[model samples]
Target: MIELVLPARRKDLGGFEVGRVLPAVLKRAVGPFVFFDHMGPADLPAGIPRTVDVRPHPHIGLATVTYLLDGEIVHRDSVGSEQPIRPGEVNWMTAGRGITHSERFEKARAQGDHVDGLQAWVALPEADEEAEPGFVHVDAAQLPAFGEPGVHGRLIAGSALGLTTPVPVASPLFYLHLELADGARFALPAEHADRAVFVARGEVEVDGQRVAAGHMAVLATGRATDLVAHGAVTVMALGGEPLGPRFLEWNFVSSRRERIEQAKADWRAGRMKLPDLDHDEFIPLPGDPPPPPNPMS
Candidate 1:
């Protein structure tokens, strides 16, 4: 049975500055499913400069998924892979034991561009945490798309509705991009009752509750939930078997405190390799003094 998990909004300051996070489930209970961040579907007037510079950071025991709705991002990692991720493509990177990587705006759009996308971190089971780092880039045409008229479903990862995304993953998870025309009603699969929906483009009605862009709707496990697009709506659905409890400090994610400490030491000692980028621009490391407290606090 599917159930709804109420979504919570969290704000964090990172190398890129302001980040708004809408977490559907608590990290402790959602095994393998750890960090999820919903980025902008922001409209940029022509010639407005946009940038996404997430500096070289270490990740362990997890895989990162980058999906873009519009615009493009250049991704570079320690493994020497570099690629520009655009709309309808998937950039899936697995940091088995540990890997460091960075994300920044593509050079062509660096001067004046726009972007719309999301980044999610999926925890790897203990068995694969230290395996080896690898990457997979799936073009937009490779993902499976289904659904009736007025509604279209794009499978970004995992299998759904007789379609599957080519991106290989370690867990039995599903990441879907769904678009619904105004007033269109769609039935979600009962198998995905535990999933969460993040509205990225327009308002949507799910289980009788209205969720607007920038907000998240968590559907608790039970019977399948129905959604109606209040307007032309775009949403992302992510779910899998829950992950075990883990610790996330700075950029390292581990199931044990000692492991995180070791990772920190390795990074500081230069034991870990930083991601390779064609350009010299790099993101600064974390641990700088916090900015002045918010006056509104």
Candidate 2:
């Protein structure tokens, strides 16, 4: 009975905003993806002060994958990687032990541009959780695309639909972006142990239940399901074998709370590293106590 649907909660981040659709009340993760954020569909008008200026921030024990549907964002990381990601391109940053980074809209596009995208945080496997911070940029043309005439799929990461993306990953998982014409149908792959669908725009029906835009349908395991588009729609499919339980605290995610604590101390003591370009503007930790107990625990 794959009927569980979790609605996204809107989050406002000043110049831009996003809808967080994952880690629902009963579910914390789908496969290795612990955090899923749907960014924008918002249009910043010209001549206004609307802008995006995310200051340098630190993260640990996970990889962040940013895929844009519209607009652009410039990514700068402690590893000295500076890349501007546009529509269909992907920015993958792994914060193993710890890393600092920032995201901001390009000056040219900040003046009246439509911004829309999805950002997913995939937790590293236990062995690779503390490896080394790294970054990779995969251009739009590099990803594989397939499916029927009206329905198209881009294998953004991992292997799916008889194709594998160039995006480097330390674990087995699938992150797919799908575009469906009216009445198009897509059958879910069954090789993965966990599966979920997030409808970004338009309407869709998965296994006979309507999934409106801004909602995520966490499918049941061990059975196949078909997704039919009620109209032109965009949806993201995610799944993989489950990693063990993981803990999350603000920007940090790890299997052990002690590791998160250590990361916090390192940031507070200025021991955490950041890129020289933006290091001077790193965000200071909030004065609140450590994050509350893990809701998924």
Model 2: per-residue lDDT, tens digit, 1-297? 375788899988875778998777778999999999999898756553413567788999999999999887789999999998999998999999889998866643446667789999999999999989999999989999887877988989998777899888989999999999999998987878888999999999999999999999999888888999999999999989889899998899999999999988898888988777675566667784543333321
For residue 103, model 1's alpha carbon misses the true position, in angstroms, by 1.2
- What candidate 2 gets wrong by more than 4 Å, as runs, is 1-3, 46-51, 107-110, 288-297
True-vs-predicted CA distance for residue 255, candidate 2, Å: 0.5
- Which pairs in model 2 have colliding backbones? none
How many collisions between residues are there in candidate 1?
A: 21
lDDT of 1 by residue, 156-180 (tens): 9886666677788886778889999
Candidate 1 TM-score over all chains jointly? 0.85
TM-score, prediction 2: 0.93
**Per-residue lDDT value at 220 in model 2:** 89
What would the TM-scores of all predictions be? 0.85, 0.93
lDDT (C-alpha, whole model) for all candidates: 0.71, 0.87
Candidate 2, number of clashes: 0
